[model samples]
Target: MELLCLLLYVTVNLACIEGYKWTRQNLPVLMDQNTQLLEQSLFREQVENMNVGQFEKLCGIECQTSLPPLNQSEQERILGYETMYDNGTRTHTDVRLRGLNTTESTSYVSSLTRTKRQVFGADGRFVISDLKFITNYPFATAVRLSTGCSGVLVSSKHVLTAAHCIHDGRYYLESVKYLKVGVLHLKSKRGKRRRQRAVSKINQQNMKKRPVFRWIRVKQTRIPQGWIHSKNSTTSLAADYDYALLELKRGVKQKKFMDIGVAPRTFQPARIHFSGYDDDKSLEGTQGGEKVVYRFCSVAKESKDLMYQHCDAQPGAAGAGVYVRLREDGGKGRWRRRVIGVFSGHRWVEVGGGEQRDFNVAVRITPAKYAQICHWIHKDPTQCKTV
Candidate 1:
């Protein structure tokens, strides 16, 4: 009788575990808009395979048979073409050839002058961040991409990042062999330090800490056509349209994700926050080790597609989510943080007369870009209308 009772208890526990696993696997998946469109097409060719006529037809620029005409707001949101044609009858094929040899004519020269008001120091503006654990709200949303870039979770399965990190204008970067997203695990620093110190004395059976990262493979990636440019295309290299969306093969329901918000056209000077895994700060012998670093600064300048700021950032900081705090709608008492831009790293621009100026730039999310990204997240165009 004793043996039978023990067997029954074990069977019930095993059944419960199996049921939980089944429920977890059946959770709904968030879909990307671009991926959905590509899947619906009859031909499975790469996007580059589409000719100018086909591209226009599919994009609803020519026949308007496939998709409806974009409203003024939507039109404003679309990242314009890389180059302009005199005849206005250009195609992607023409863009490929013509855009290759063109050069920017505008030039302005300026020095990297430091001001009391500017956050201009090499490492002053940025600091190593201690995010406690994966339970933190915004920190939990941060993810490290295998391509040596940082990205943020906008949905359970979608990651938003800079296009250049994955594709450098022409082809995908060599580092992007198999895209992967790494989410940091929750571990106490004091406990970790103790474990490291006792490593020589402790046997394998005594250690209980989990691995640092929970890595998930990426299923698909999407970037705007405007970001693909010829080698000599100056405007494209300005990093105006440097944004991309990644869809992971599995959803990360354990960690929270961030919401998207539009940056106001004009407002009082405000401080914006962003965090990323900066390479310089994450070196093996660095004091902080391989931890996420954070920075905040005031906007220096704003253009139609980009925002200039003085945030101190290194190469690996590209694709960090630029977010700001705002109150909830309808005068709700709760405050929320929403991502308004994507950090595109440092850029050198011609101010005028062949002179160059250096600034850290971010790709601002306009209403249209917000809508497009929302569509990517929900796979429903109607759901993105709120932005």
Candidate 2:
């Protein structure tokens, strides 16, 4: 009788502990861990509600350092400012680098500049000796929507791109838009070969449907963030949550759509490939509307908060996906390609300039990005892969 009573007491205690854990996971405490986040979100909404030249003094988000005073030059350059509100009045100001509040004097496009070059190689087949060294690889295409950006379908309605490519402020889909990807000509022997290989007469059907390249509009975009941009008041620019998933308007008919695979923990820098439209190229010498690919090596050093990779690109390629191949453990060490970043591009200048040789910031995509994107991918029962 005593033994039975002890067993019952132990089981009851275990159940109580499990119940407490379940409650903690599902319930919210008034002062929760996301308190800073809540504060930042409220502050951003207040700032976004302000009009040009209508900012409140000392209006800023929560941070250790005192907010900087807005200089005339800085005031006119606010892209997306974060503000503080007290008693229904505005109080602080922290500016974004692009979008919404872009001031004419302080916007990224205002400082736009680039050098155009007319690439040449051997006639017919490409010759390795004729092009720039290190920049001799092939490139793929990428695109953008209201939320974020995406990539092209290797040969079908399915497009292989980033997970954070689409966002709508919150966990909503209203901000999503159609997919628009275009391929471009590269300035290298290998780039030329890939271009020819892509457009060979034998592959005429694969020839982009339009001169601008037929864009396969997106039907749906999926993301796994329950609360995007944070419901709190503090927003960290640090690299943490990135990556998203996008679905094309139609299912790809071919079997070429494949994941880039995974990245090894110890990755190396190499000559990375990219493709995009350069408004400067057209301004200087490009013919009517020619699609082009660009190849360039990433900078040797990288910034902790900023993602960097070298590629000849420009503003129009803002949403371009940056990718690299890394060796992974698959029984033995095997080389597989994985996307590590997105072309947030040079928020401050043109792409691939001999200038600013240190950091070419790209948005780093990590495992968190993959999980968020994949959750969106397999969300709907109908869209889930059959296995």
Candidate 3:
């Protein structure tokens, strides 16, 4: 039953892309759907309660120093998206991202913002090279997008990812025609000594580049009209809706996909976590092709639509699921990890006075988005009536 609920939670629309009648009827049902997500906010509230003193210790001495005020501009923003069916149909709908008054402790927030460059210099990323751990729950949910990005499994046949991955709101990327999803399956090691030496030596060739995923053909892809560029709006605003869903040809047997969690736009947490495939250079040592890199950090800014952070990331990390681990409601301290946003990667934004400032952004899934995504995965509005 939980699995059924999860799949129902996974689907939604990206406008007219898939030829779905995402009419007014669908929107109202989704807008009025039951929100069983109260506990999700409860867990988020607990995370936001961490005080500046606690953060001071965790953030270390870097917070004690200050860096020049920053404004950013970058090309890695999630912009332009569309829904494409395997048979060659397309759709789109616009979602908006807006900021709200932040009430988080200013002091604690300052600590994290200050450390974005000061402390995280030279890359703080770690590789999940251990085959045993990488091919299991949580980590196993991470997958590689054919377009040189990364994504996470959300339902049996659906994957959640950045909208900008396959579409630019105008047309699909060149790779979209031959899109594929890669699943890194676990394999038996031939010799313990060889395995030990390979792992110790950090030799990906000796390891046979297991980073190569088990490839799966995509049945369809969906993105919001909001991500599509137009004369009426800018790409930066479209980024708020920079999310997409891909349906695979089949389900992954006996594998686990993550559940969705939602928090208020203004809410802030002590830490945010995510993992994805990146090139060899971003890692500590040479990693041959690509490796699943994981990192956690505090959010610098957040709004109704987007989240900004300074977590170390490089090319190919886009579309990775940004998740949080918190205790389940009434589970008596039992913890759960749920995906709350899709990493949008680096974005250089032109701010006031025509200055371009860059940010490592993620698109937070708002209730409206959750419902739309759920509708995409379930294909039935009734199943998507609750988060």
Candidate 4:
């Protein structure tokens, strides 16, 4: 047992020694706000045969996992690409990466100037709720991560959220082992009928008043290892992989989820919107209130992966889906709402030589990032061809 322990320590160290590094080629293509953004929709042949990125190797060689059979009974994988790897710990096939030829680096430009005052608090600004409409299209898709974080349903069986919600830089969170998603509970007709026939003094209005939810089990989770602050990793680089996907045991049939898309900072509909189960204490503790708070604001500043904004939010609001109102690709210019980023709440960064600054930011969804998320959502390259 002593010898085995020693070998295991050395093995993990070796993996750290080969600690992953980000190459410009493996990172998302950098574009300025003034540039014309080319929307991405990856084909099956392209994604399956294409090479993965540096941070994208969540269960890379170190974890030794693989593609799980879709119909497999037991769940053995949690943070890997279902298409590229298999389930369990084992040595797997390796794909050769294309040579790097760029000298570009990820830049972090700070934005302290404000377009408007940060809107938060319970004074009827942006931090508002509509419990009666929780069963609507987009609001119905909002969910609680059980671990105090918020997430938006991006597909029938997947929830897109911040990686930090489920995993720290080193390992998965203790809460993730029993992760459950809480959906707004639907009203029952039988219960309504009982209330009408109530004779006891304990009436419907006298009953307990609290937000109700229908919890669901999570089957697996996936995140880019880049999000992991490895022993030799840098925080700025790790921030690029903040977004992740959570696969639920079953799909929600009553509600429709929002679709994922690549929306640059300068997208026409400049206003950004999202909703979350904010924990900020409020004075109005009325029936079915405060469970889901909605907010929207203009983009203040943005880097390749991060976008600093004036949107007011609290700790519990992190991981909420950031979206916008825009027209579809070719739907006769029909307006549509799509997710473009994941609200990261507050984050600190190095602005210059030994100077650190903090900002309320979200992870931007670039073309490459969109492609990866698409693969995870549809699983088939064919079905996930377009964003």
Candidate 5:
């Protein structure tokens, strides 16, 4: 009778354990499927892929489409083509596709400056500058990430990178070392040396904020090696949470500090920028020891929980920050910046005996993203600013 009672108790406990596991595993799958179905229905109701002719008719540019209109110059500039020269008296410009080498598209921007005189009034000012041709710089501090890996600085004491950047547990140790931050163009300041010295001497001000750099030391890394389990390894699903935050030995100088910005309640329509050292262009076999920075812009007012951008970048530029520039008070000296997303890298799969391309995804830094990072920084809820 005693043995029979023990057996019954064990059977009941096993059943309960199996039920709990089933619930834990299937709950998220059901929720995600439901969400996907809803999104698809919404997308179908709003819009779908259409051919070129349909787009032109819908946009009311059909009459202007048949031939290269004389107004081609004006149209291109409005489409974010690089504006070359715009003297109040003259106008010149250039427009070209990125990453493509074609002489036809490489028209001089100076010519556009000459054309602007006819387009605008004599007193009209040239708002754009030469440096504007380059893409906007992003990231307060640079980080290294594995392919599709990314991280954030939640704590002043900790710098985050992808968990896969450090450890793969069963297969590999992601082999990441130190991370550097607060770098600016080495040439940006040297060009203005004369005026900078005079201004510093007159005001007795330290202008470290003049696009110089400050470096931080990554003291320790925090990640669980066992997270990449074998059963889940083939699917690569575990990498969805492929994040890690590091504990820095000390904080960078306050002047050079780049605060992680809070996400807006209703996201503003703003362009984003990102920069990173990509390994694809780096010398083979060396582990991202060289620096390679590239910048790209994101789609305006996107809806994904993860902030998505259209910039085409190579593999090495992972872990780059997607940031938006904040302009206020008519763009005075009181300028500030904030980060909105992270370059999560391309999500790819082997198809037809070769790898097929997919969209370049980045980690959206929402309010939760900022809070988690801030918590890691102070480890005290009271210290985090409500923003």
Candidate 6:
């Protein structure tokens, strides 16, 4: 009887330990979602009371040193100053894009062609991209979300993506079982050739050249309060604030990440490039063979919060980075690429009188949004001061 009692105690303890582990693993997601909802009223009250320091603390951000005030003209050009709700109520919050003080005042000219193949047409659908693996700029920066969304690495351990990809307006999606980021593992040349030979000789089921991916679990996720709205609220459909930032449990090694940048103040048609694991093109024999697909096109139009383009993309392409090349340090010849937007995917906007217009839209990374994202990435407002 004593032996049986000992075994029962051991079994109960083991079960308790397993349950604790499972709860601990999933606690962050539950806490984050509930915190955001419960803190909504308090956040609004604090913002209304102008308690900046307390507000920052509650939002999981450290208080930042005051930045140099922008001039009147600069303030006008920046976003968030004139942000309005669907009901025409303007937001009083001031969010500035960081890291823009170093950029030149003049607009940067783009060298891309104006006309390109339409990505939405029947012939343009499911088009395979020509981007080489691990040898390209944007391709190396793109990562796949376990939720079937695409994301871009903004920092070594942070990913920038669309908020809707992880959470709909009301609740988190079912596919977000656990936040994981998958990066492609490039194979050595010798290993690639050997695998090819093995594949030819071995049976299909026993092929040794299976694609490899390194998946890192996500530690935390943050979504803008603006993106969270009631189902009946018009702001729920607004795609302007559809961006999110994810903090990975660990850093990616040996892979390059893209720098986040602000969109140009003035509208200038420019070529934007993005890579993603589109679902339609994920099957074998498709373009890129289950690898990340790249696409580029000139900007069609720009609103205060969204950029419309015809980049060939499917459902799974949501949350991909929309990036452009710019002169680095205002140098005469040196150019650097930076991500300026988060792809929001196809959206239908109410035109008027029940008419809706469809367009492929990306949420522009305004200065205010940049500050918020940077805070999420670094957890310190001071570190994000420079963008």
Name the lDDT value of residue 225 in candidate 5.
Answer: 18
lDDT, candidate 6, equals: 0.54
Q: Which is superior by lDDT, 4 or 5?
A: 4
Off by over 4 Å in 2: 1-212, 223-227, 230-233, 236-243, 269-271, 282-290, 303-306, 326-335, 347-358, 378-387
Candidate 2 whole-model C-alpha lDDT, 0 to 1? 0.32
For each candidate in the order shown, give its overall lDDT on alpha carbons. Answer: 0.55, 0.32, 0.58, 0.55, 0.36, 0.54
lDDT of 2 by residue, 1-387 (tens): 445434533432232221011000111001101111113212122122112221112211112023333333342222122111212222222222211121111111111211222222321111111112112222333332333333533334434443333332332222332334433223222336667776767565444332323444555433222113444413312222233344555653332333432222223434333443433333332232243333334443332212444444543444445555433443244433345455544322323322433234454433223322333344332221211
For model 4, the stretches where C-alpha displacement exceeds 4 angstroms are 1-129, 188-211, 231-237, 265-269, 286-290, 329-332, 350-357
lDDT of 5 by residue, 239-267 (tens): 22334456666764323434555434333
**Weakest ten-residue segment in model 1 by summed lDDT:** 18-27
Tell me the TM-score of each prediction against the true structure: 0.62, 0.44, 0.65, 0.64, 0.43, 0.61
How would you encode candidate 4's per-residue C-alpha lDDT over 1-387 as one tens digit per residue? 445434533432332221122111222221111212222211121121011122232221111212232121111011122111112221211111112112222222222221112344443323323444555666677788887789999877889998868765455555666778888765533356555687465555455443467788887776753464455433322555677788888887764789887755353226677888776664243223346676666676555556767678766777899987654443345466778899876644445353545567788886556656775677444543344
**lDDT score for candidate 5 against the true structure:** 0.36
lDDT (10s digit) by residue, model 3, range 1-387: 445324322321111021111111222123211212111100011121122122112122233123221111111112223457665655443332222112211111111221112114667776766655567777778889888779999887989998767765445676777789988886533567765665755464455534456889999887754565556543222455668899999888745789876643343444677878865463553263255677777677665456777888876777999876654443344456668899876654434455555668788875556666776788666665444
- Runs of candidate 5 with Cα error greater than 4 angstroms are 1-140, 143-157, 169-174, 177-217, 223-240, 264-268, 280-292, 300-304, 327-335, 348-357
Which model scores highest in TM-score?
A: 3
How many clashes does each candidate structure show, in the order listed?
Answer: 7, 42, 32, 5, 21, 2
Write candidate 1's Cα lDDT for 1-387 as tens digits. Answer: 445434533432232221011000111112232211111111121232111121111111122122333343223223332211212122221111111111211111111221112225555433333333323566667778887779998988889998867765555554455668887675433456666777664453454443266789887776655565554433333344678888888888754678887765532376677877776733432233246666666777665456777887776677989987655543343556678899876655445355555678788876556655675678565565454
Comparing 1 and 5 on TM-score, the stronger one: 1
lDDT of 4: 0.55
| Preferred candidate (lDDT higher): 3 or 6 | 3
Which sections of candidate 6 miss by over 4 Å? 1-118, 122-132, 187-210, 230-234, 282-284, 287-289, 331-333, 350-356
Q: Evaluated with lDDT, which candidate comes out highest?
A: 3
Candidate 3 runs further than 4 Å off: 1-28, 31-82, 91-120, 189-211, 230-237, 282-289, 330-333, 349-357
